[model samples]
Target: MTERELIKKAQAGHNSALNQLLLDNYSILKGYLIKLTLQKELAEDLTQETLLKAVTKIQDYEPRGKFSTWLIVIGKNLYFDYLRKNKNLRNYEEYDSVEKNRVGNQEASAEDHVISGLTFEKMRETLGTLSREKRSVFILKHYYGYSYKEIAEIEQCPIGTIRSRLHNSIEDIRRVMEEEGLDGF
Candidate 1:
């Protein structure tokens, strides 16, 4: 069935239709959540929450765009809500332990191994320093391969704002990498 039909059925109280809609768009939603949160468990939890919220608010959904877009908006809001509650405090010890394990498991023969580690660390630090809005645009555009137009729609901002954010983010990353002496990487 078409998305509109599925949405109609879902709004009409068809549980199966709603489930199908969620199932069909699950990966997209999960990917967006993961990119936003950078934590698998948190992303999964937010995905479920987003789906539930979408279902509850399904009746208010207008057929203006793809249903998946609406679902993603819900997920994005939930992700921000999680961030607000968590207040950017992460377990640095756990993060370092995981990084150490990952580094040890890497092959010695890997290309650019010497610079790769520094580059990645620098990039992570730089990304963390970016404002939430700029980081969101960068991740959605580069990591998730979202178009500027789609990002604007998802972010509820103008396309020009998305473009500007992405541009500024790339420049910031470049400057940070240069300062860290890993620009060649």
Candidate 2:
């Protein structure tokens, strides 16, 4: 069935349809959250909360946009709330795990692995320095390939504001990369 059909059934109070809809968008939402929060565990927790919110609010869902986008909007709000609640609780285990996984999957030489690890480290550090809004804009646009207009809608801001945030984020990342001598990346 089409997504619209599933949504209609879900809105009509069919639990199975709702479960199907949520299942379909689960990975997209979780992956987006993981990238946004840079914490796999937190992302998983937020993903569950986001879906729970979606269940309660499914009646209010409009089919004008993708369901994944709506989930992301909800997830983003929750992540912002989390940041407000825990301002100093940064964790790097997620990044470490990501690097380890990459190394495990790659068949490249040790020197290549070292260079890749350094590049990933520098980029992560640069991202860490970005403001939450700027990082969100950057990740949504570049990492998730969301259009500027889509990002504006998800962020609940004017398109111009999204553009400004994205432009500034790129500049911030570029400046950091240059400073770290990883500009080629």
lDDT of 2 by residue, 7-126 (tens): 999999999999999999999899888777778999999999999999999999998888889999999989877876877435422211221111122322322332343466575667
lDDT for predicted candidate 2 compared with the true structure? 0.75
TM-score of 2: 0.78
Candidate 1 residue spans exceeding 4 A from truth: 86-129, 179-185
Estimated TM-score for each candidate: 0.70, 0.78
Q: Candidate 1 at 71: error in angstroms?
A: 1.7
lDDT of 1 by residue, 33-142 (tens): 76566678988999999988998898999988777788888887777777668776354223112211112223222313332434555655666666667767776766
The lDDT values for all models are: 0.70, 0.75
> What are the per-model numbers of colliding residue pairs?
0, 0
